[model samples]
Target: MAFQCQRDCYMQEFVTTVVSCCPSELKLENNGKKEKVKGFNVILKDTILFPEGGGQPDDRGTIAGVPVLRVTRQGAEAVHFVSSPLEVGLEVQLKVDWDRRFDHMQQHSGQHLITAMADSMFSYKTTSWELGRQRSTIELDTGTAKPGEIEALERAVNEKIREHVPVTVKVLTLDDPAMEQVRSRGLPEDAVGPIRVIDIEGVDANMCCGTHVSNLSHLQVIKILGIEKGKKNKINLIFLAGNRVLKYAEKSYTIERALTALLKTGADDHVEAVDKVQKSVKALQKSNLSLLRDMAVLIAQNYKNNPNRGNLFCLHRKEGDNEFMNIIANEIGTEETVLFLTVGEEKGAGLFLLVGPEEIVEKMGPRVAELLEGKGAGKKGRFQGKASRMERRGEVEALLQEHSRCPHLEE
Candidate 1:
């Protein structure tokens, strides 16, 4: 039997007797965590809420004031998952979410028009389609579209919408002669009753189970956004219909205004302004790196020239990198002194390098890593790695000082 939703796509409310309601559970993800929710699977004599099928999402609404989370078709029955159970044999009111339903109707109907025009004009067959939340897509059998083909296709689809063509449904038996003319991807194995064919007068006739508008004008308009490469030798045509096009435009305008304000330029100059800013940032970064390298050499030379400087030396730079630390280590020479250097935020995660006698470096490397809440490995006379707790550097400095004072203790 055809569902009431399939029978009357425009029906918003219907009174039906509850045939059955049983305990059920729905699995859902909340904030990246998966959880199971307890619910009831309700079956009604008929429903205004369409079950998920034919690439259209299930309608969300209420059944006897209980929220319906999902609906799916099992064979001949439409199972509605609801928050609360409805008593068997009791009459209940079922409501359809009109806004969502209408949006789907517009997109589905628009797809039919586009598919027909593409096949007629370009010999491109629609192998598959998806009606998404933001935009919809139809996969064509061909790998590519000719220049101006998409624009022509878009113009043709909108012209049909302007024509206000009548869209009607026909219920035909399996043996009906008219079924031969209808386009189909073969009926479902468990399909019961007559097959429903949607006819767009003077355009196309296709077998479809989903709800649709009775007139092409209801589509308002169809916008072919662009094309995307698909698997194998197919191309997916992206598009927007009715309210979705308006929503997309509104969002795009909002982003444009924000960019214009931040760049202090008009929409037309946004690209050039961003490019110029990026180039300037890159030049500044290059200059800063050169200065840091020069500073590293000067600091190392100062320590080497100072005869009064202790065997243990420590330094931290907010802007130094691994290369800067290596440069300093090479300049000062680690044979006679223990050099402890760090780079990045003083109280946060950063890089650390320790260089000294092989014995001292190997023994103190792991301890320094632990105090900084990090890890490191060393061989010969150098140790280095990333540190997570730069705030604990004082502890590492103290350990190094003690080692320098009693250099023969470990030996």
Candidate 2:
């Protein structure tokens, strides 16, 4: 609040008149954090500030050359808060930063164009919209889309952006019922007085409180990211326009440049580089498997004898990456008649099999599993079990040697 303007008597065009009157020599309040501009916040005053309401961000810029950090409506008054201390009653020239303002207008107006296009082309009504820095989104009341239909809608919208339609902003108070014709009756629940409508000229007309450009020409471009389903009958659309498009393009260019150099491929040839990675992965898998096969043969050669035909048992346990050890165990199991336990990283995790003669494997395997604190559920005339701890390795070896002493373990 300006020191000169009383809470009750601040005129409607108060901010413009008062700010112009104050000189830079006026004293500031609160040292700096919050500064009061003499002629700020009055209705109808042409000051550069985005008002806060309707989920839209507050307009930001300098007033009197001092940055107006934010703008909010106190009752009907638009209060402009400036960073640092502002000279009270100081005369300061007001300027609106067009570049930033233009970008916001582009996205906001683009939304109107989209909503209008959707209503006209597909009988869809927009329920809500969000204007973000990188993207904008619109929620519509109906959605049952196929890929082809989506593509067609996308193409239609881009065509409209290229066409460059006209958008108009209209401000109306609640007292005037004529304002009703300007937009729908969906006045916000929080609307204390007038309803501001952003009409896309002859295009879309709706009651919106957010700041928008005066014309659609300012938008310049639009890009749709995707459509997401909202409730049962609604869908949300994600898009970008103007500055957002340029920001996305700049980021994309950076990534493409880095990838081109790293992968040694032209922009169009990135796919070939990706395919090369897949081929390399496949080759590595084959080479690794061959190594496992050779290790299996060495383990098989260590087995003492083939009991009931080709059945053989060899217990070799170690610690490492669980998958690697499991693969080595699998290789050893495949080579011998009845390859037994080859425990690895997962100590309690071991291999079990029964291979040689069907009867011998079926009968002794279960008994061996019971004794070894493991399972031989699968039979190949071999049974594998895990030792509880590293110290249990000796116990397992002793048990294997004792297999000769035990009648059932012999098969």
Candidate 3:
């Protein structure tokens, strides 16, 4: 027998007897952690909740007041996963989530209309399709769509929707003559009983197990968002139908309003304003780099000119980068003096460089990296790497001071 959902897509409530309830484990994610939740797989005599199949997600609702986490097709049965179990033969009221079910119906039926029109009008074959959370996609066999072809296709699809074409379901045997006319992607090996076909009036006839709306008017409208390059020799057509189109438009408008306020520009000028801001930021970054290089040279020259300055020198710059540190090291000359330089937040993550004698740098590099919660490597007389605990800068300076005092200790 056809499942109650497949039999009547419009049914919202139904009374059914529990055929079986088996103990099962359901995996759930909570706060980014996966947990095995104990549950029961309840099989009913018939169900109004559609199972996961044909690229449509399973329906979510309640069974006997218990939340149904998932519904899956096992062989020819719809198994509803619930936290509580119902006794066999016990009658329970099952309520389908009307909003989710209706949304799915709109998208599924919309796909049929689109598939048929694309094939008839442009010779584009739908190889596969997916009903996503916010939108849906259809993978076409062709690698590219001709200019204006998608726009024309969208017009054709909406025209059918406005026509209020009727959509009906038919159950036929494998040997039925009409079965030869329906488009199919083959049946599952475990598929049992007769095949169910969805007929979109004079538009399309396809063999599908998923539930759909009864009329094209129910689709409200379908908007072809755009196309994306798919796998080899294929293109994915992205679209939203019915309420999804409205929701998408609402969200897009909200974002545009927010951007308009932030950029102090109208919606139509948002792209140009953002581009201008990006160019300005790039120019400022270039100027900042040039200034940092100049400052590095001056700092190194200051240290070199100080005859009374100790061999140990330490400096930290919040805006410094690797290039700045290297410039200072090269200017000051690391042969006779130890240079400890760090760049970034004083109490957060940053970069560090230590340059001096080869032996001293090699021996102190690992120790200093560990103290700053970082790792580094170097040959010759320089060591540098990233550090996470820039607050430990004082401790590093102290260690460098002790090493300078006892120069032979590094030997």
Candidate 4:
């Protein structure tokens, strides 16, 4: 939406004259497509809703009791996006979303104080910042900062907040002497006429075009959450301000209480409790594995003593594994026998078929899986594969019996 703002905006409630209600163009976000949405951009002579700019989000509320979807700045005008059109030259009452507006003020003001202190105290210059929904971040021109340094900076910021210093905005011309005192990365190329500078009493003065609270006390408090390493050797300091600090504290306390109850240990002992439980689980797994190995050996001996079903020995055990089958095959030694083993009949099935004379097993292994509508791989005298057709286990046993009689036929 394109429009021009003749008067300065930033009033909580204001009466404005509607200049025009025209079809506005909006670029769709986050689809990598150059698409636009149709909406009415209501231009006002003056407005309270701040347009999105300077790392801050747009203010949303009602304009003439109609919900304003978004506000954008094209040149000097504040354009309000709404569903329906308003009559040109109609007078409308613009009400800014106070809760959202106040929250942004707290965070934006807190950032200025923190950035100023970071530069004055530690010589760390702020490169950029982001005003997020839950928290805010200021990127400093440094690789990293130590815990002590951050703690000290937080303390200094809170001290300024308690001081309740007046936050003032001043519009100065390009050649004004106050511009020399402004702390900024640089001015934009298209920056013309007067410049808006947010001055935090005696602490900071920076060229910015964002809304801020009237005083530092409105910030309530500033807490440094942590720091992240950003691109190009910069450090991003994560923080919360005003109501966000209260919300964060409430959530942290709730999480700590829940952890204590679940672990059956106090906050200080929770880590130790978790470590002890992990060790016990590891010991139990080791004991279970040894028992399975012993059981496999005894099962192998039973089959070795009695060559069941003539020369075709077949065993159908539920949930047996390839490891158990391999152990049984080794225990039987080098004998002239064929073993057809199957496991997991109810859900699915797996087969381990071994035939004497390694060459016969290698050639017949893949064929056994094919007969069961599955796939297999083998070498030496053992072959293992999965059979999706569990009902075909009986057919596999029958094939082994028929092959046993024609052993010389395969050779």
Q: Which candidate's TM-score is highest?
A: 3
Q: Which predicted model would earn the best lDDT?
A: 3
Per-model lDDT: 0.93, 0.59, 0.94, 0.80
Query: Please, what are the lDDT tens digits per residue for candidate 4 over residues 165-193?
Result: 99888877778987899887776565556
Candidate 1 TM-score to native: 0.81
**Candidate 4: regions farther than 4 A off:** 1-10, 25-37, 189-192, 274-411
TM-score, structure 3 vs. true: 0.88
lDDT: worst 10-residue window of model 4: 1-10
Where model 3 places Cα greater than 4 Å from the true spot, the runs are: 29-38, 84-90, 336-339, 354-383, 398-411
lDDT of 1 by residue, 44-83 (tens): 9999898888888889999988989999999999999988
Would you estimate the TM-scores of all the predictions? 0.81, 0.55, 0.88, 0.66
> At residue 181, what lDDT does model 4 achieve?
91
- Tens-digit lDDT track of model 3 for 1-411: 579999899999999999999999989778999999999999999999999998899999998899999999999899999999789999999999999999999999999899999999999999999999888999999999999999999999999988999999998999999999999889988888988999999999999999999999999999999999999999999999999999999999999999999999999999999999999999999999999999999999998898899988899999989999999999998588888999999798999999998988888999899999998988899999999999999999999999899887743
lDDT, residue 77, candidate 2 = 54
Candidate 2 ranges with C-alpha deviation above 4 Å: 1-46, 162-164, 173-185, 190-193, 230-233, 275-411
